[model samples]
Target: MAQIGLFSSAFFTLLAIIFCFIFRRQAWIALLCSSLLTLGLFMPVSFGVLLVGTTITYFLGNKSQNSSKIGVGIGILLGALVSYKLREIWMDSRSLSLDDFWNEDKPWQIIGLSFFVFNAISYLMDIKRGYIKSTDSIFKLAAYLLYFPTLYAGPLHRFNYLNEQFDQAKITKKSFNNGMRLILWGLFKNFVVAQRLNQLQIELRQSDIGGWWTLLIGFIFFFYLYFSFSSFVDFFQGVSEIFNVRLKDNFHKRVYLSRNRHEFWRGWHITLNEWFRDYFFYWQMKFKFWRDKPYILLLLTYLLIGIWHGITVKFFIWGFLNACWILLEKRWKIPERMEKNNSYKFLEIGYHLLICSLLALVFIFPSLEGLFIRIGKPNFLPMDVFLFQKRNVVIILAMCFMVDQYHRWSKDLRMDAYFESLPSWKRRLLYLPLILSIIFFGVFMKGMDNYYLKF
Candidate 1:
């Protein structure tokens, strides 16, 4: 029931691994039971809601042959999702503090409901399209919906992909080694990199630093957001792989190297964007009006994506700005034009980096007014204000950037594969420092919650 990054969740994962090996071909049953038990322990109310939602979705898919009934079912599910969003918006609008109303113990604070609901919707849609059939086995349905590794924030996998692997899933030596390596790398990113950046941001904000420091905070937040998000995916995907359940790769390593907004999105949150593209954008393109006036639909799609993060004005602005930049790039053929002059590569990269860092301000501040106030503030803080030494921060960031570049260069091969190809001495030399950094600098005591957990 504990979140994936927590020690308790790791213990549960270890147990699940042992249980799966003992059961052999029936490993899926052990997986399902462990998943359900974990969910029940962490969030019993949410777990009950998940079961009810999954059961309804399963039956609705079964009865989907009746077109009218299926329409009603789809509407009901959408309505529920909309209602949840509205309730959240209302809570945000209220004068009462969120702590006074919403908490982990509250029934309305359903963790991962947004993600699983989207999965359920996609399941029903896939059934209607005849791409996949609804299973008669409720247990399999439960396993697919409530798979523990992805039950929190997810790579947003499809039912067909996971269901096919469940029965045959088992840990091999290669998988175990790869999974452990991923776990260690993820720990380093989250604890050593992201958390330190978080501390720096907090210190800057408390100091009310402005000018270049505000811009630096924005840059810090961009990397912080990336590491906080991608690390969760890496850690959980590693755990899932140990069970031989391969989840979708969420982040492309080249995301930060992107020269434009469109290219950046293709590399960042790859699964979520693909989900919107497949289920929403393509579905709209079926209409002649949407096809003819595609940009209008594109803008609307992004607005929906923004609201999906949270029904807030700041998010709406963030989505709108992103759509505008993307549209500008497409209409002007910016990236294509820039490609002709190789000398302009740095200019192109800087342009995107600046835009993205500014856009990150929307997420880092609670309100647009607060963001402007900070940017407009005349005073500044000295480098001495950093919790971790500023020089150490720079060194860590540079190291990460260099590693990412290497990953980009070897995009054809997986990181685990590249590691395995190295001699034992080289491998030990590489991972030994990484393990030490995590052990010394990791921020495990504060909390294990990820940035995306709210969504």
Candidate 2:
């Protein structure tokens, strides 16, 4: 039954692609309409909310003056977002069991509401700021808001960027090939690597292991989060590419290899960080008071970012600690001072990586006490058991590390150009192993839900 369902889905998807290709000149319209239908089918309530929100934003942008309209639009979007988050908090508080405390399956919860609301608010702000003209056409506004590739977990692309791309959208042979490559790469990362890491993490947490062994779980979790989120972005970006629409890049290739918190954030979730910087951080800094006290503004920005993830105490602490680390880095000028010394540079990289991985424990464990108990207890599991259980995971991690190193070395050139420079036989050989790994080791039946999807 599952295979039949899967086959039917693939068949319809293929038909949709063919239809889009046939009407290539009006590809955006076809994509937008199909995306609306799909979203409506799976998440009807979310679809309704998005439709009404987009309509309200459209009218506000069109009918009112730039200044007051922007404020009103933002207020409406923020009000909706805040209300939804508050409801989530209230529901969590009322849960009868610990297992239900952080339940993701609440009937009232709206998936992707946070992302779309942020995008809609940005759209309004950009109009007032003259970054892009307000569209008179509601369909264009709908297209921007309902674009499926970014509708769920987004890169939070701007209206101007997407609008400009739509003006010249056309899929080429090269783009098609590149899209396939990205899709295959994403599948390998999500299914073969991230899923395995998630499984290993669950196993370690359930075990009696403690001390340094528990610390390894945190590191595993950081990688799992990275791969899972990045893989989703990659997959959807590839889908957009096939339609000749280029979405913004979310993760930089060397994010994990970052030497400082600023560098890490600049690379990690590139779009979201930039959105906060532009719409929230820089906007606040324009005022004299905030401009004079930049550190406070910075702290507030990070805190808001934390609260953006969840309206919870743990997320707040996560944001506060991250803000402190960045401030410390700025105070010492760590990146600048350490850049000239190779030894110091290596140490800085390791320090930042370790700190980030450790900080990730704030999100992984429900409480600080649980986290401390896992990390502080002296009892240790047998080395053989640990090695035996995680042998596959270690091998996968090594493979990912090697690929990342190659990307680091080739950072000067575009990945597509580098791949094109390779001989056809070598390229085919490279694809062979990636495809084989995804087929044989991929966890398809479980762990498909991405970590970032909840937000």
Candidate 3:
């Protein structure tokens, strides 16, 4: 059976998009109606909490002129986020269990809280800075808060941008076609590439996968993570475009094509990074001590990013390790001449492949102890077994690489430009196989939850 969460997200998002087209003149009302339907379907409690919070913040933030009051508003939102992140610990302390959370009788359960809280903080901050005019319209505020496309996984849409797009959106035939193209490509990546790698991931975790196999598993794991995340980004971006709301681009070609760790950090899950930069990193720069020690700021930013995934030791180290690499780069800048040298570039790619592969182990294993134990137990795979165990996975991996390389070589970072450049007939012809492929490979498969939603 298809995963209900995935199926419903696609179904309701399509419903909302159609609503936008039909009620183009009354965009806010259309969005408000569809948004409520979405919340009712997927997250009824969450919708109530979000509405309460939005109502509170709208009045409090708009009227508050003092810095301390604004700080209080921001603090409350951050507190809610921190509380949700540490809820598992809270549940343990309270002797609560899965049943307690899953039981419909429970009044409080949290999912997708962080994304909403982050947006809430941004909204308050923007209001304080006079970036967005404070509004009393509950419908519009609710629509912005409850915008379904980004409620789960997000490029973290800005409130002002969303408000502007509500009325000013221009959804042309060309843009509509491009949006369709993105959604189809995203489905293929999610259904084919990510799903195939997930099977390998299950096996790797279960078997005594060690030594070189550990690194192989790690790389595959990262690939799955990338495909899963990028797929949603494509889907969300496509949906946003249809509404003429351009959600921030979270992934760019630089993610895979970048030669250095720094570049990868800058490009991958870009809006999240940008949020950290704006809210956390820049805030730290105001302090004289952290301003002098830039690396400390960098470390804190990455560590925050890691723990935001979940309050685990594994995530802490993952953030710390990335910070260390970034700091090391800052201390020893690569020579411009060496950066361009083919030999150096080749070695750099290999270096990233190795380091990233190993670092991804942090994500695969839950704790430091498990990761160390797995590393210590070296059970190298037979070449034939490794290669032949999942021939379809190998084919998909190769095809993904070829597609990425084709885009890179063509100088179209995103294939949108290239695809749009095609003749209308050619574009329609291409869309046919893509649509069929999705039906054949995607709709029937057991749907996977978005990996990031756990955060």
Candidate 4:
């Protein structure tokens, strides 16, 4: 069933590529409509029924002048999303409990569902506060939910962003060149590096190793998966730009350069992080219970951040641990002058990575039991995974980091623009290698499924 579903989706994706070329002006609508149509074909359920119901509800929900009504409507959709546990539910597996109503499956089809939920709630809240005017066209609203480039793994987009391209029709050579590069880059990361590293990660986890060192390799792979997958976000964001749909870029380099936990969260998985801060955190801050006691408010904020990712026992512990880390920073009096010293700069980098790694380790183990069992056991390894290491995964990792670092230090932003600005001869030299590498890696790789697709 899974293979059948995957095969059909790939077939439809090829068709989507053709439509994208043909309907250049309406590419956003075409891309999304194709994805939605594909979903209906594979979904077994009627897209019309779901579309009509969601559209009507979204319109009626936004029509309200009262803040509370919009809040209630947003809350209901959020509740359905949460109840569905759309993130890690198993489809086709035997039911372990009654809550398997919305398992992970092509038929259930929660693609872009999380992004849509956040965007809708934001749209509702924004309308109530006058930050956004409701689009009268149900088609436009539906298109926003289904926009294909971002729907799989977002650069979380918004309606206002889409509004600018309303009548634009040109797909210039520059746009096509840049867009193809990005799409190819994304496919390379998704299909090549991340997938290969993931298999090794699983092998390390399931292996019978006697020490904490092997456990360290698990976390290293953790970082690899994150870097490779998140780069996909950049890749798609670039491709979407070619179509003139400027999707938001989700990563900020400041995460690598962050001075503290507070700064670090702002940089990582940033769209969702800021989404929580603005939508959930600020919303909670209005009350006297939260406002009067700052410490309590801080604790609740981090806890909410954790649970927003997943509602599980480990998620709560992960959230609480994060809150503790934040509160410690607040209570500690690290002098500002001393913090700037060279040693402190070193300390700050170490501290941020440790915090990120700790939080990420919690992410590794899904339950409290799983987390505890893995803790105190070192997992790092210089293992001879000959297949991966032989394939130059190490070299690939170094190159990926080097390119990212170069992008950071280089004053001229936008790699595409920078490349275009190069001398004609120099430009050809640079372009040939990038183009060749894409063809080389792309043909040989067995790409992974979208990581967020699990969620």
Number of the top-ranking candidate, with lDDT as the measure: 1
lDDT of 4 at 146: 55
Q: List residue ranges in candidate 1 displaced over 4 A.
A: 1-5, 96-107, 211-213, 379-382, 387-395, 405-410
Predicted candidate 2 versus true structure: per-residue lDDT over 24-130, tens digit per residue: 78777776776677667655777899899999999998745467977988999999998876654676668644335334344454657877898898899888877
Q: Estimate every model's Cα lDDT from 0 to 1.
A: 0.77, 0.76, 0.72, 0.61
Regarding lDDT, does 1 or 2 come out ahead? 1
- Estimate the TM-score for candidate 4: 0.81
Best by TM-score: 1
Ranking under lDDT, best-scoring first?
1, 2, 3, 4
TM-scores for all candidates? 0.92, 0.92, 0.89, 0.81
Candidate 3 on 1-455: residue-level lDDT in tens? 12645665677667766777788787666766777787776677887888787777776776665456777878888888887788667765788774465453555655567778887788777777767666768677777777777775687767887887776655677677767677777777787677777777767777777766778878878878888888877776676666666667688754665677877877799888888888778867989989898887889889999999867678888999999888887677743434667677767777777889889999767567888888887666545445665676665666477547545654734555567887889767766755665566453356753677657
> On lDDT, who's better, 1 or 4?
1
Worst 10 residues of 3 by lDDT: 441-450
Query: What is the clash count for each candidate, in the order shown?
Result: 0, 0, 0, 16
Score residue 413 of candidate 2 by CA lDDT: 47
Q: Could you give candidate 4's per-residue lDDT for residues 1-455 as a string of tens digits?
A: 32333354455456556777877757656666666776577553535434653674466555675557776767776886686563444432454432343344435555556666777777677777777777777767777665555555676655676656534523567776766655555555554456555655666666543245444545556556565656568566665656555566676644555677766666677788777777767777888777788788778877877776666666778889988887877677443443556667877777666666556667765454665566545654545654545565664665466446545653444555555666789767655645565466432333434555545
**Candidate 3 Cα misplacement greater than 4 A, ranges:** 90-109, 335-338, 382-388, 409-413, 436-444
Query: How many Å off is the CA of 235 in candidate 4?
Result: 2.9
Q: Which stretches of candidate 2 lie over 4 Å from their true place?
A: 1-16, 96-106, 379-388, 409-417
Q: What is the C-alpha RMSD of each candidate to the true structure, in Å?
A: 2.4, 3.0, 3.2, 4.4
